[model samples]
Target: MLERLFESTLWNSRFIVILAVVFGLIGAVILFAVASIDIIVTAKYVVATYLSGTHPENFHQDVIGGIIGAVDLYLIGVVMLLFAFGLYELFISEIDVAKESEHDETQLLAIHSLDQLKDKISKVIVMVLVVGFFQKVGYTQYSGALDMLYLALSITAVSVGLYFLGKVGK
Candidate 1:
């Protein structure tokens, strides 16, 4: 009887995962909210600058960089959401609302195994990195042919990685 009780308790310990699921969701919500605020601020800045009829140095670059940064945050938030959903489904229970949804897109959050969850999270992370790379590139000044060549090589590498990533989904 003691052995069975211990076994039952050990099995029930999986409920601890609920903490991670809840906190991950909270983190995702915070990230999404911050990203939205960033975009709103960027929009206001652009509108104010145009209305003032004064284009600051690196104005376009700044605008693009801000938007790209927000995209990066949003992608990271997506990763957090996927993590939470996967953990909950794997440990707790299937989300009833998602299962009931007629929209095929809801299946994106359905995770059947650890590998599937990892793949989904990694893909979103790659997107975040790509966005961050572009955000950094936007602010970089190319001073010479060698710099331009390096930039081209880096972009080619990113493109190749994305191509392979896409093939993995197929």
Candidate 2:
């Protein structure tokens, strides 16, 4: 019994790691794209500013903070994303196992359910983020461009979620 318990604990640890990695890959891909965009935009701005021979006060501060914060957020998101993905996978696994014993077609059904779950979660996050943006802007000033950026990021996240749902669940 002691040996059996040890084995089970070891197995669970490895299983958790595998699940974390699976989701981390997708999360990393998204973060990589975002980081690349930031780098390109910032590089252009920095070069243009230097070339113009004008020192914008506090410009260095924004550039440094932006670079650091962008990476930090992506890293944090990776950790969180992995945990969320593991939970999502556990649910999908449970459905797969439960249906396997009864049905000739379990994968397809499980995939559909998982896809729907992903889309629903993505929509909820987007809604909340948009509402927060509106609240933030309301307290200060409003910018149409902010709205557009929020919309674009939300759509991108949803699209990526859809792709993963099809890959893992289907």
Candidate 3:
């Protein structure tokens, strides 16, 4: 089923990209909305309403703050999820690696091709992971951009590896 998913039309289609963009857009909107909530809530309740003698309960403050914070965090999470799905849609495609493994024979081109592919993939992965770690630590946005590039390159390597196998299979 997992293999089929990578091979599916849904994955290759533009629909997935559109869905991902929408999710990111919604998340951004949520973030923008909640960011102003703090100012508005404090201004209205602490200043304007206070002069009118409408003091709210203290415990309610914590509850409301927590709820708003949670919503903000959830929006960020949703954005990340959508961006990840976008990356998957852009870079990943299916080739039956299992099929390659099951074959009893090997050709020189297959071996060399696989070796080169492995080298390229491993280097790219390590580089991207290192960059991603830095990005996670908030050092730079460039690292995050590089991570997307690496993901695309990794997918291309995989496709090339599969093509090599096809050539050797013949």
Candidate 4:
């Protein structure tokens, strides 16, 4: 009887993780909303610039940067969603919708293990970082050959990093 009581108590504790996972889902939803807003605002900026009829210096770069920033936000939101769903599926239960879907094997939300979840999130995060770096470099001005060389080196480094990230688990 004592062993039964202990087993029951331990099993019940699994539900505690549900609270954290729900909060994470909510956070991901909020991030997605914010990213949507950001895209809308960027569109407005582009439209206003177009209406002004004056090609300001760096206008193209600014618009590109804004778009990239929005993409970064979206990628971050994706990471959050993957984290939440991964935790839920790992600790709680399989997602019914994913399980019933015809394309269950191809869906991003079909996380079968913690390692898969981590890999998915890491790839998205690396993409976000790469976009962020590009957004910054878009506005950077190089006054000398050395500065241009440094920029080239930075690009090479980022490419190498991405290559290694892709090669993981292989």
Candidate 5:
């Protein structure tokens, strides 16, 4: 009886994962809010600049950079969401509402195994990295032909990696 009680307590300890699920969801919400605010601020900047009839030297680049930064944040938020949902399903219980949803979008959050969760989170992380790479490249100045060639090669590498990433599990 003592051994059975100990085993039962050990198994119930998995509920500790609820802490991670709750915090992960909160983090995702914060990220999404911050990204949305960044987009709004960028829009205001654009409108104010055009209305003033004075275009800063790097106006376009700045706007693009802001948008890209927000996109990066949004992607990270998605990763957090997936992490939360996957953990909850794996350790706690399947989300009943998601299972009953008629929309296909709910399928995206459905995770049956730890490997599937990792793959989903990793894909979003790669996308976030790609966005961050472009955001930095947009602000950088190339000094010579070699620099430009390196940039081209880096872009090609990213593209090829993405192509193979898409092929996985298919």
Candidate 6:
């Protein structure tokens, strides 16, 4: 009887993972708030620039980079959200609210297994990386054809990698 009881206790300890879900949710909220603030600040900058009627050198590119950075933050927030939801569903239980919703077919937070969760988070992370790369490239000055060629080659490599990732499981 003691052995059975100990085994039961050990098995039930898996609920401790709910702490992970809680922390993940909190982190996601913070990230989303930061991303929102970033976009709002970027918008304010754009409006001020427009009203001032001054096209300083690289102003447009600067604005674009700001927007892309904001997008990267938003994507990271999304990744956190997906991680939280996926962990909760995978380790705890299926989300009943999602199943009951009419939009169940289109739900993004659904995860039936660890692999699905990994796939979802990994894809968003790649997107965030791509956005970050673009933001950095936007500020970089290309001094020669060689620099541009290098940039093109870097983009091609990223594209190929993304293509292969997509082709996985097919």
Q: What does the lDDT come to for candidate 2?
A: 0.58
Each prediction's whole-model lDDT (CA): 0.96, 0.58, 0.49, 0.87, 0.98, 0.87
How does each model score on TM-score?
0.98, 0.35, 0.31, 0.90, 0.98, 0.92
RMSD of 3: 19.5
Order the candidates by TM-score, highest first — what do you get?
5, 1, 6, 4, 2, 3
Ranking by lDDT: 5, 1, 6, 4, 2, 3
Candidate 1 residue lDDT tens string, 85-123? 999999989999998899998889999999999999999
Ten contiguous residues with the weakest lDDT in model 4: 99-108
Judging by TM-score against the true structure, name the best candidate: 5
- Candidate 5: lDDT of 102? 95
TM-score of 1: 0.98
lDDT of 1 at 9: 99
When superposed on Cα atoms, how far off is each prediction in RMSD? 0.8, 14.6, 19.5, 1.7, 0.7, 1.5
> Candidate 3 vs candidate 5: which has greater lDDT?
5
Position 116, candidate 2: lDDT: 53
Query: What is the Å distance of residue 75 in model 3 from its true position?
Result: 5.8
Model 5, 1-170: lDDT tens digits are: 99999999999999999999999999999999999999999999999999999999999999999999999999999999999999999999999999898999988999999999999999999999999999999999999999999999999999999999999999
Which candidate number has the best lDDT?
A: 5
Error of 1 at 43 (Å): 0.7
Instruction: Return whichever of 2 and 6 wins on lDDT.
Output: 6
- Candidate 4 has an lDDT of 0.87
Predicted candidate 3 versus true structure: per-residue lDDT over 60-160, tens digit per residue: 45445544454444445444443533343344432245236766532211322434444433443444444333334332233577887876686677667
List clashing residue pairs in candidate 1. none
